[model samples]
Target: MKFAPSWDPTTAIAQQRRDAMLVRLRELRALEQRAVDRSAEARPVFDKRGQLLPRERVGLLLDPGEPFLPLCTLAGYQQDTREAASSIPGGGMVAGIGFVRGTRCMVVASDSGIDAGAIQPMGLEKILRLQEIALENRLPFVHLVESAGANLMRYRVEGFVQGGALFRNLARLSAAGIPVITVQHGSGTAGGAYMPGLSDIVIMVRGRSRAFLAGPPLLKAATGEVATEEELGGAEMHTAVSGLGEYLAEDDRHALGIAREVVASLGWQQERAKLESDPDKDVLLTLMPANLREPVDLREVMVRLVDGGELLEFKPAYGAATVCAQGRIAGHAVGFIGNNGPIDVAGANKATHFIQWMCQLGHAIVYLQNTTGYIVGRDSEQAGMIKHGSKMIQAVTNATVPQLTIQCGASFGAGNYGMCGRAYAPRFLFSWPSARTAVMGGEQAARTMQIVNEAALARKGQRPDPVQAKLQFDQIVEVFESQADAFHTSGLLLDDGVIDPRQTRAVLAFCLDTIAEAQTRQLRPLQFGVARM
Candidate 1:
């Protein structure tokens, strides 16, 4: 009670400071509310087809519980202007370092909220910065482009210097050893398409997206030829005809999911070995029919050979002749190739494209041989089968990735070699005991021998007996036993060995493990270049 008589001036100052802080907190809350209101106003622009914003796309691609490091957040010059500040990021692009499926990657997503996601001078700088980071860290790069090409206003403002710089950066990224993936979600026209073209893999969504060197309006005005948007640049047209994209996903979500999966498959620096449990032996025996003419589904054998729930088949409906898929055996990624016997020209083209893409992506290829030969006749020739077939062969032969050949049945003629025949130089060449490998089958062999027998009988002035011809055929079959025995090829070490059908998975797993250990010591040349779409 006696101390209350002296009041310090410092106590009064402390009370004033507390009151100031309370006032500031209230003002800050009001500011936050205003920002929320502005965002709500902008939501309709992004909701047009329910598309995600650039930031949201980045969030979806990254692994859960991981944070991203935004690259050059203030790179947009337009954002510095009052008119664009409310919509665009500092730059037209938003780039950062992020993780996908626990693997580090560099991501660059365009802001559709700003000028329809156009590329500006600052946007190009943002992309270059991210590319440089990717090169430095040896990480994969992903591009989510939904743009209207270069920003004319920015280019005019910069006096044409911006264009050269952006193209140069694109070229540099294309040459970088790290994998680059690009997805086209909206209107990717003219220069917009170039960005995705510079990437190693391009994915596009159906209906909701379009990509072209020029917009339809521009084309009609320039060439005096009118075409609809779909006719000019639909997913099907680009994927099948232009060959711009590696995959055509069903929608935006599917495209992003595929992008994540593709990146995960390619993140490793070295080939990985697969470990798989033994599949049922009887499954193989019963999978294919004994009748040579009967059509059997190739997917049955592919599913059996690869680990369950790990197969990702590419262009399933488009490529009926070849089956290309990525699968895991014991948590290791492996590429699988199987023949969809007797397919049309379209199937051949699709299969070739898949093989080429797989080789470029650097996956260990496993060939499941079961094809007669390339499609023949006038129709096939007209369809450019020769050109497409040659492309497939070149891709296979030039592939530096480890290859394993498993001949299930009917590896006849050139088709056998094309599908990892012993001549193509595979790490291991194996055959099932029942596999019939020859220039032709037994029936064809008999016909040729019968002709020879008849010619001899005619020369000797004796009637050629059907029974005698049969005896001669039997004798020839006995003599050719050395060529037919699976052990002979393995014993000579020309082929690896004859593996039991059930033991295929186990054997492959062991081989993959063995090869992976050896491959880790060497650095494979990263020579793939991004194709201009």
Candidate 2:
């Protein structure tokens, strides 16, 4: 029998704080959901135009009741700065991994209801990452594309340049034997025309879909040429005359039906054996203290995750703070690196060794993150913390195996770097609802700045102003705390998404299966992508 983690529920102040954290997490999620609803609900104009909302189109494209693991819903969040009231409607796209006619594929839709589905700077980043995921996983890419092209008035030169890669990736997917299917539900002029242009199969909705290199107004302005919407790039012209669209649908629903049929015709079959569930998985909720101020044992969390709660710890005593262990999640072999406390020189070295070992074994690696950071002090500095920490980071960065990170709490400082934080580009990254990430703790950051201020005052031959210093410190703390929370990081698209603690095991297993399937599947690589001719 696998040993179960000793259950200990927080009480008094700890319980009070944890409860507050839960409330805040819910509030942030509610705010994000409001943005989603706003995209679908506030868009009455779609109904007037006799069209479905972006989300509705996504729903119709997927198999009913199938799981949809939505990615990067909160991308480019506060980065926009103008509309901080609600999130930016999923960075202008509705995308996820789901089933269509029993074939697993990546489904994407432009949230045209918002800003006419103009791909924002962050929207561009989100699509780039999504395309990369689809390519990496060897999954068919399906897009419900209806973009108004890039926002010309708000355009950035860098974004314009980077946007070209989107079309290139579409072609790459087809060349890699991963089919690219697109449903053109509306305008796709200028740069957006390539979304359907580069796809292996294209379905155009009659009377709605349009794909022109330049719209009529732009053509008239740039040249003496004159053309109507229909004459330029209408569905009928593309389907019957231009050979741009392989199939033409009467409406949005019909377009989605044809897309599903395209998936069915692919002849792909995926057999998944359901991992045995933990009868007492209710523990996923109660394992970590709601407040990151309290201590957590990653081992305790790990035991509950792996099969039979059995794990083989690697080098337990040398660097006790940083933990390396081996276990099986859903019967898939996994190597885990977790934190019980700060990582020191010894811990970094241990992690470096463990990471290299996992790479040699060709196994998947999981990071259970929770640390204030790598240890700092004069004594630690001389001990080569930087060198060893660099080695650890280097190992994580170059590991040949698939790596996934779960932010449980306090993903702060170089600890975040050493633990394969978002910047490290793990195949999949997620955070628990209460997880907090920053360069350091809010108090720590404030104190460091306060000391600097005091030193400056001392040099000016004045006594340290305690009151003035306290006010400044408090302001700094507030800024750090607000931005470090999981909601904020997720809003910034640091991780894939903020998931409920209860879903960690299932999420981990699903991703493992995805990586495994990709590894085993065969692809026919071609020198060039399939041309529309």
Candidate 3:
């Protein structure tokens, strides 16, 4: 039987909650737009150089009108800035999944409009995340390279150490046979030169492109050598004498055109036989209750997400609180695990078995996280909650098939770890606007601390001051509550992005398709990445 919603959608309370969610979504979109606007402010400078802006270059590189799912648009949000209100997002780069010459690829463009595309600390993390995605999905990496290199004023030793991973990923991508493509639009100095050096394919724009281990100033400082910028690392010299660039263009537009042609020439389109599919009318018709605290059936969500609104539940009678099922989404088979309440010992064991079963079947796993936590207290401990929970976590960590997570609701304590939390490195993780993540609920944490403090006071033969105790409790609650907000966590790059609850199916389908494509595609691995002679 198809699951049905239990709550009335037309109620005023539901509408108000949805409105609040929409408001938060709008704020997210506005911040994303602000990054674009901040980058656009450099258009005049770009125009003077006869160069297209970063977004414009990305637009030209991507196929016209095909969906582009921008990743980490708020990566550096409120990070590397003094105040949240004045913070610029996008991490000095625009990166996403988009079609290039009809082939889906990971695209990254340096937002040189801001700070000459200097690498912010979070920006480094953002690129590392993108590289990880491209590698995991076996997607071609297309980078529009331009930067002033690292900002010396903001340099940190840790950041310097972390920067090595960026180049290492480039080498890894090439070694894995996933193509590494670079478009050298401007400066790439010092260690940055490795970008083009490590790529399988390099396209450079004449006069503008620069890639050298040391610029004139550094060279002069080290060896007292005098040389012009052109003599050091100009595109003309690299393409002619150094043989570092295979394709050279006159301008930004011409360079992008070459890059597109190169991608189209890869013959990367290998289509999988289409399976008969169910329409999404049922999914669209269902609306999740706006009040996040209210209990709702996990089945209601499963029916809306799976193909034909059907699911074959696995071990339903046992560990009823932990729902496990097999379902198809967009014609691809997948296993889903969702929570209805705190996981008991039985629930943990049930989930562990289900995870291994799915891996054996070679189906990807989708985790719908909505658990308060694993069951706590004396009875649960004796029943082996710790060991059972550990088994589930172990199963999740070693599952051969891809795993994806959606923070649909409360993700607290070790429950998050068992459900493939961000720390466990799910292939992709997204959060709903209503989702909240923390070690425990704010009230519970406050109460726990109060109990501890009161006991300590009693040992000292002192009675707690009622007013002061209340104030302390309030402060603790505020700390946890503010940090647990989905928006706040999202701003901190805790998930891929905060998405509308209604768009969960679409997002899942897109991610599944990406993984399927990678599995089927053939690659040519090499002992080493391509190198400039």
Q: Rate the local accuracy (lDDT) of all candidates.
A: 0.64, 0.86, 0.86
Clashing pairs in 2: none
Tell me each candidate's RMSD, in Å, in order. Answer: 30.0, 2.3, 2.4
Superpose all Cα atoms of candidate 2 onto the true structure and report the RMSD in Å to 1 decimal.
2.3
TM-score of each: 0.45, 0.94, 0.94
- Where is model 2 more than 4 Å wrong at Cα? 1-4, 10-18
Identify the candidate with maximal lDDT: 3
Instruction: Please state the error at residue 483 of candidate 1 in Å.
Output: 83
Which prediction has more favorable lDDT, 1 or 3? Answer: 3
**What global local distance difference test value does model 1 have?**
0.64
For residues 282-341, what per-residue lDDT tens digits would candidate 3 score against the true structure?
332223444456765677677778877778888888999999988888888999999988
Show model 3 residue runs off by greater than 4 Å.
1-8, 272-291
- Candidate 1 per-residue C-alpha lDDT over 132-234 given as tens digits, one digit per residue, 9 for 90 to 100: 5455445677888888777665557452555655555656655655567888888888766676667778898887568888778899889988888888888
TM-score of 1: 0.45
lDDT of 2 by residue, 273-321 (tens): 7878776565566656666877777887787788888888899888989
After TM-score superposition, what is the CA distance of residue 252 in candidate 2 from its true location, in Å? 1.6
